[model samples]
Target: MKTYFALIFSLFIAATAFAQNDTTQKIVEGRKNSPDQEKKPYVILISADGFRYDYAEKYKATHLLALSSSGVSASSMIPSYPSVTFPNHYTLVTGLYPSHTGLVNNSFFDRNLKESYSMGNKTKVADPKWYGGTPLWVLAEQQHLLAASFYWVASEAPIKDTRPTYYYIYNDKISIHNRIEAVVAWLKLPAESRPHFITFYLPQVDHAGHLYGPDAPETEKQVHFVDSAVYELTKAVTTTGLNVNYVFVSDHGMTKIDREHTISKPAAIDTSKFIVSGDDILVQLYAKDRKDIQETYQQLKKEAVDYKVYLKENMPTNLHYGTSDDWHNRIGDILLIPNWPKVFNMYGRKQLNPGTHGFDPYAVMDMHATFYAWGPAFKSHLKIPEFQNVNIYPLITAILGLNYTEKIDGTKQLAQEVLK
Candidate 1:
């Protein structure tokens, strides 16, 4: 009887131990399959510069259309006021307007730095002081995710004192095929070294749009070329067997401009009294003295009949400009915005491009850009109405599951309808 009881107790202990080990193994597997422990999702943001919203409809871009059919698309992506390149690109990444980003235009004078920042000025372009708000890549790195960029605006700059995990300085000479291959190679990196967020920029579309009118055959050819490149990139990424969420966007669209509609500076206004910035569509006049402010405003108001002039404090509320002191210092004492197809000149002008942007976003359909997203995270066959470009930053962060606490103007609500 004693031997029987001892044997039974030993058997009970063995059974309990086996059950506990089985439960432990199940818990480990559960954690391994948890949403947080699974392979992290990847996001690839591609920008085909000057890719107007209508291009997908007008051109033979079967790839883009197919992607749109499979994912979410917007009728148009409304650009921030000034509807230019650098400002809108930075806005898309930082979720801040040009006024807040301190990149009011493609080229602006930094009063504090006492230096001019132009697209052509490589040194100044790489300087971090010129950029404001936290860039997407910098935010990603802070959360232990890696980021990479290829020829993105302000990507070369060490924004917020940190650069992307991998980046390339702007190099127009690099062929599109080479750029695509480089991106593929980056994607093929070891899982430990791979980047979670990647940015690719293609400027050929914008260049073609500037050299020729938006509807010209040359522009159409370039658009097709861009489409083909994008298709190749998608194919390459798919071959890697990695799940990637792709987002295609453009900074702004191009509008036809004519040489016949030129508005030169009025002779009454002294050129030396103020410094002016901006191109034909928008002119920013900075008075040298406080007294010249009213004079410049009155002169521009009286002489420039084709353009609308406004004092800095009285800028249009819809523009979301002139509120920040940093932007105010960069802007002019008097703002001049021309009517459609009209050009304003501060100096003797040369031949202008057949197409250009920087028009008021609300007034011109041509100023609207493109937005399309495709991936597991997005709903298929979803079409959303046009929303501000500022909202893209929040949508991207949300998709990456990043914790963002900045006071950004963007909201995920603008893009929530497209998410699964």
Candidate 2:
């Protein structure tokens, strides 16, 4: 009886330890902002995933619209090609296109790593090796400026051997009130330990978008949810008297797909000859045999319907994807980007979710995401034209007064246009 009780207690303790790991924030020890760095301005970069470009006006996201109108608002922000959640969010911070960043898709096979990266896989999500480029948080930390994340893609991973000084592993269990409280606490920290750069993410809009089509009332409800929550967030922070800068954006927009007319996985694909990753909107096939690439590309092209097939080298150059820009070689050998509203039902489900994104933003307006900014760092009442998401990296670095000379796809033009 005693032995059994001891074993049960040990198992319980181990389980409790595992659960506790993700439920709280992780702070890096022995890190502090320099006196000069601590004096830098504060920025809370917020992403409401899948919040469409027109959502503020269309859905009446009042706080966001009003805030942006007071500062700067863009017509729309063009997401990197194949606009999707993971790649574009990473792009927003790194100033690199998806192909160059080694995060080519939400789920993609890395040829060199000989492995797959999927958002669902916790182990891969936390692995530093899978991430490339110096994310904004990492850049700030290296320069001795503290950073924090309420949540953002890859913020958990210690890319470049550094993560935000204060961050929590992704968890939906925490309530909005708790999250807001945490940020308030961080702002109240002693100057040396306070964070000047922070990332905040809200997933409710994206969740509703994927489950209920963008046009559905459920999605609208979530949009309102986001609007309310952000209002609360800003209001709470206002008490801190820090004059924090705010830049609100999203990874991609949501589009309703024709579920009744979904495409099937091409019969031409032979699993033995390739490894397939990615989803319906953008299908990526990683070739097992180098010689197999061209042959498969031709075969896919011949049978293609409602989709455009391309050899990786032949993808549209304007996308900044494929051969030359594929510096990390993570893009697949063949690509299949389907026409809008005609998604590939690869998993053989009865149908796909009513709404999804990952289309070329230029071709489908719905693929365009949001961009709005206010607070001390920006010019007031300015509206700019559509710009690529990659430019966000430099815009942020410029605001924080952090310097970098690394060649990135984004231009300094955006900073010149909007900054005060």
Candidate 3:
């Protein structure tokens, strides 16, 4: 009986030791497969323009919701001040605010260029001088990593005297399927030719939102359509058998607007005293001289319009804008941001659509965007609070294992919470 008891005890100890060894092995293997351990990590950043943060809860985006549930998702991503398309998109890749980046608005007058740069002006859009800060693709090239882009804003311009290894100018005519196929083709390139980083921009959702409002059936349909395209793209990438980190984001959200809520300009002030820029939501007024600036400021402040006007010096501290000299030159002498639902109608233009943005980022949730990340780099089943869009730049650089030397506004610590 004693001998049998001893033998049983010995077997129990052996089993415990084996279990300990297995656990240690797993820990080692996990560390080995971690993002930091990978020599060449592939990252795909997709931007679905105007995808609202709440869309994940409102729409039946099965694939996107699955990604959010299985991976790391934020409640929302806050855009920089003057939450508009061009400014926020550039901010995401550059880690700089609109004012610092010099792309303050979709359209602005550059005193240096002596020309008004509008989204419709392809020549100015392609001009490198209009863009400020080094874009991610340029950073990737500096690190000797191959990069590619598909119709992302500023990708057409040669930023920092460098363009992506593979890129196409903005083309709305291209079908979504073709865009997905093109990206997949780039991924299928031989190991030596494949780009280490890639970016894709889908504008259909934003277009639908602008034309048919966020609550419209067309917008919901577009959400599903974009979700389907992303699902297909994921399947294609999986077929390639490459380990890719995927980041899905949007520039800003959309909100309903109507002509009834318009705030007409006061007749006391002359419109010609300053060159007005920006859209109806956020209006920028640039004056020719200090006297014009003071007159415009006083007249705008005295007006009973449903908007708050500020001089460049007294702008909101939270905006983190107007600090750079380039920004000072580009930003307006008098800034006007209308109250929510009350768009500033400088010329009383007919309301073409029921949607717009560029409201106070804190006051209106419609200005917020979506942020979802998944891959070997991110923790699974994680949900984080809303964060600023600027942080995305540092997070991406970290995932790529590239050393970032620029003095960017985003910090890697803000993004490390989602990493495993």
lDDT score, candidate 3, position 78: 97
lDDT of 2: 0.91
lDDT of 1 at 66: 93
Q: Which is the leading candidate under TM-score?
A: 2
Candidate 1 weakest lDDT stretch, 10 residues:
23-32
- Runs in model 3 lying further than 4 Å from the true structure: 1-38, 323-328
Model 2 spans with C-alpha error above 4 angstroms: 1-21
Kindly list the per-residue Cα lDDT of model 3 for residues 1-420, writing each as its tens digit: 999999999997886455323311000011112232235789999999999999877998999999778889999999998888998999999998888888888998877666788876666777888888888888887666778888677887888878887877675656777777888887886665667788989888899998989999999999998899888988888988888889999999999976686878656456667777888887777776668778667776888567888887788777765534346378877788887888878787776578888887888999899999998888999989988999999998888877777688888875679987
Please, what is the TM-score per model? 0.89, 0.95, 0.89
How far does residue 318 in candidate 1 sit from its true spot (Å)? 0.7
Superposed on all Cα atoms, model 2 deviates from the true structure by an RMSD in Å of 3.4
User: Which structure is stronger by TM-score: 2 or 3?
Assistant: 2
lDDT of each: 0.81, 0.91, 0.81
Which residue pairs clash within candidate 3? none
Decide which is better by lDDT, 2 or 3: 2
Put down candidate 2 lDDT per residue, 1-420, tens digits, no spaces. 999999999997886556445768899999999999978999999999999998888888888888899999999999998798899999999999988888888998988879889987766888898877899999999999999998888998889889899999887888999999999999999999999999999999999999998989899899999899888989999999899999999999999999998889998888999999889899889988999988888888899999999888888899988799888888988988889989998889985789899999889999999999999989999999999999999999999999887778889899999999
